[model samples]
Target chain A: MPERRPKIIGFCCEKHGLDCVTLAARSERQYDASVRLIRVPCTGRVDGMHILQALEDGADVVFVLGCLEKNCYYDTGSIEGRKRVEYVKGMLAETGIEPERVEMFNASSSMAWKFHDIVSSMKDVAERLGPIRPKGGGSE
Target chain B: MIVAERKPLDEIAKMIAPYEKVAVIGCRSCVAICLAGGEKEVNMLVSAMRLKNRKDGRKQSLDGFVLERQCEKEWVKEVEEKILDSDIVLSMSCSLGTQTIGDMYPHKIIVPGLNTAIFGVPEEQGVWSEKCLGCGDCIIDTTGGICPIARCAKSMLNGPCGGSSDGHCEVNTDIECAWYAIHERLKLQNRLELMEYVRPPKNWSTSHSGGRRIIVKEDAKLTPHQKRGREVLE
Candidate 1:
């Protein structure tokens, strides 16, 4: 059998999360190609459904990257983002999925290393989890 | 307002497994304010169910919509087309909203995504407590506006029950004794004599035991308006 390349999704907030990614790019630091980043205005804008929908669309793992807690440009946006991630994690657990498949992270615009670490951690999780089975015979 | 919590996802998944197309309906009224069955909840449920179906290879198609209020005929009508199109409906509203949708589309299957928790308000950000029992009669005027029927463990009308201790109910230490609260409130207002009035047995006819209850506003009916329309037609 061939290896299953993991599909990962990151809901990145425009303020700090995406800025960190851009900063990493300028520093010649690269992230895994398997991770797809969808930029949003704020982490709080990423609803619980958005995370679940990504999983349904074949993402092996999904994470929300937001500004540091209490440092959100929208005051409570990152906190709201964390709440949404937690809510999705609970739902995933209830549906027999690994709750860890969905996660939340906080970082500052200057912290490219932190963003890279987040990606690497999610990549490791996705590799171990393998491709998410769609509806039929993917039994955990 | 009615408060509810989402039913476990596994239970909801099992409930809708047999359906091919499901319409997940949400309400933007009380349940919305309570954060149970509102637009966000509707979207969450739909996404979760669809993800589950995909993982299980079930091929079930789930769609979602948030109605103004599923309990109203006009609002229910807004989603009539979608409700009719789907094989089943999963309601994220309170029990009344679910029942209203079921009544509107008698031919469709209706499932509730939330369990009606209680009639209460948020004490804080995410904490909710029961407040009203809709006991058909209210004596809050004399009870210093505290509802013993809903808050007291024993629903004692005259005063605190034997179980009340240290301003707490015997049933749970976390629950403050309603009678004690009423007493304190009445004392502050200098209306302690109101407690001396003996209340009559509650009229249960207005409650669930008396069967389906209805309230009609006779004065609010538009009979005169209809009569004027008829005269204009003549």
Candidate 2:
């Protein structure tokens, strides 16, 4: 059997989070191709439902990348994002799912290395967990 | 407002296990404000349950809905068809809402998704503290707007009991002594004399301790003839 490619989804804030990813690509840094990036106005806009939905939709690992807490473009956007992520993690733990499958990371526009680290870490998680398999197959 | 907390996911899963079609309903009332049951909560719960079912290889159809107020028959009637079509309903509201659905559909199974916690006010963004006991009496006027029966662990009518120390309740150090607060509040209002006035024994008949209570307004209720006319119209 062919080695399975882990599915990873990242919700990135348009401000510093997206900037970090853009700079990483410009610097000729390569990350896992299996990872999909979603751009949002701010990390605060990401709801707990979004993270859970990603897992239900076959993403083995999901993450929220936001601006650094103290310097969020929207003042407390990243802080709010972390709270939601933590809330979802609690729910996942209660439901007997691997809490590590979901995570939150902070980044600045100039931190290309942070973007690479976040992607690499999430990719590692996805590969380790494999796919969240439904009874007969994938999600309905 | 009535505060509630969601039940454990495993318990909720077990309640709907025997049903093929399950409707997870929420209310936009007190439970919503407390972040226990609302539109977002209903969706999040359904998604989580679906994931659980999928992992366990249990095939169940789940749908989510929200009502303006679950305890009101008018809003419940709006989703009548959805209720009748489902094998069971998981109500994510307070007990009043759960009982409303249960009473509306006697034949269908209605399970409570949340434990009605308290009659409280939100102290902050995520904190809800119980402030009312629904004792069916009002005595806060003498106590500086704070109900001792609700806030105090002993519900002592006169003052703090022997358990009070340093303005805190012995039951829990985190809880402030209700009488201590009452004294401070009264002192602030310059009504410290009210503290000296002894209060009489409370009448428990007006409270839940006296069986279920009901209030009837003659003017608001329809007469027999009017009820008949409305019944015919329906």
Candidate 3:
């Protein structure tokens, strides 16, 4: 048997969230290739269904990256995103899954370091949790 | 609109655990507006149940559907095939919607995914406050267009209870005393004199206390001849 690499999914707001990630890449910073990012118009558009579906599809860890709550591009988009993340976490807890498997992070366009930190932290979580076992048997 | 809250995920999970095929149905009317049961909620719940099943090493098939108004027979009829195909139905609507499906198919297993809370209006973006009790009688005309029966702690029709303090209900500080609000509204409308006229004892027979009440609209109902004709057509 070989070591298994964790799979991670991140739902990022196109506004500040994507900007931060893009800037990090431009700065020659490298994050794990296993982390896949899905861009949306705003964090508010990321519903709880998306997060749960990610986990259900076998992603070890999932997260939403949005603009800071106080300075969201759409005023309350980040707040809404945080609320949905919290709701998903509650559902996960109820389902006997680790609530920490899903998380929400805030970022600004200029904060490349924050993007790296978010990815690193989420990657760490995925590594710790390993892959979520599929319905029948083997992990994805 | 009727307001409701989703039942805990564990409870819902346990409800359909014995069934291999389950259908999660949601209503797009009041439950949708309240963010309790709707298309999105049905999908979320299905996904959550799937994940939970996967975690527990259980294999169950779950499908999600939404009805325009689950309380209506026509809307429920549209999904009759889907309801019949499933071993159990998890209704994500108010009790009325749940009962509609149960009534339509007495032999099928129907369970509620939400706890019907109140007849309320959205106070703000995410807040819903109970505003009516469906008492079957309208008395707001004498109470400044505010129903003290629903808002007041004691449902006192005459005036504020002694426990009311500083415009808040004694039952719960968060509740605004309905009588105080009525008084303010009456004063604002320059109808303070209306308060002096004491209300007589309310007739409780018109309310739910009277036991299952029914209103027959004779004009709208089909006559015996029409019923026979419709039966022939069917």
Fnat per candidate: 0.79, 0.70, 0.79
**C-alpha displacement of A94 in model 2, angstroms?**
1.5
Q: How far out, in Å, is residue A110 in model 1?
A: 4.8
Docking class of 3: medium
lDDT by residue (A92-114, candidate 1, tens digit) is: 88877789999999989999988
Q: For model 3, how does the per-residue alpha-carbon lDDT over A38-110 read when each residue is reduced to its tens digit?
A: 9999999999999988888878999999999999999999999999999999998998888999999999999
**Which number leads on lDDT?**
2
**Pick by DockQ: which candidate is best?**
3
Output DockQ, candidate 3.
Answer: 0.66
TM-score of each model, in listed order: 0.87, 0.96, 0.96
DockQ: the better of candidates 1 and 3: 3
- Candidate 3 or 1, higher lDDT: 3
Worst 10 residues of 2 chain A by lDDT: A131-140
Query: What digit string (tens of lDDT, one per residue) describes model 2 on residues B57-140?
Result: 778999999999999998999899999999999999999999999999999999999999999999999999999999998899
Clashing pairs in 1: A135-B54, A135-B55, A135-B56, A135-B57, A136-B56, A136-B57
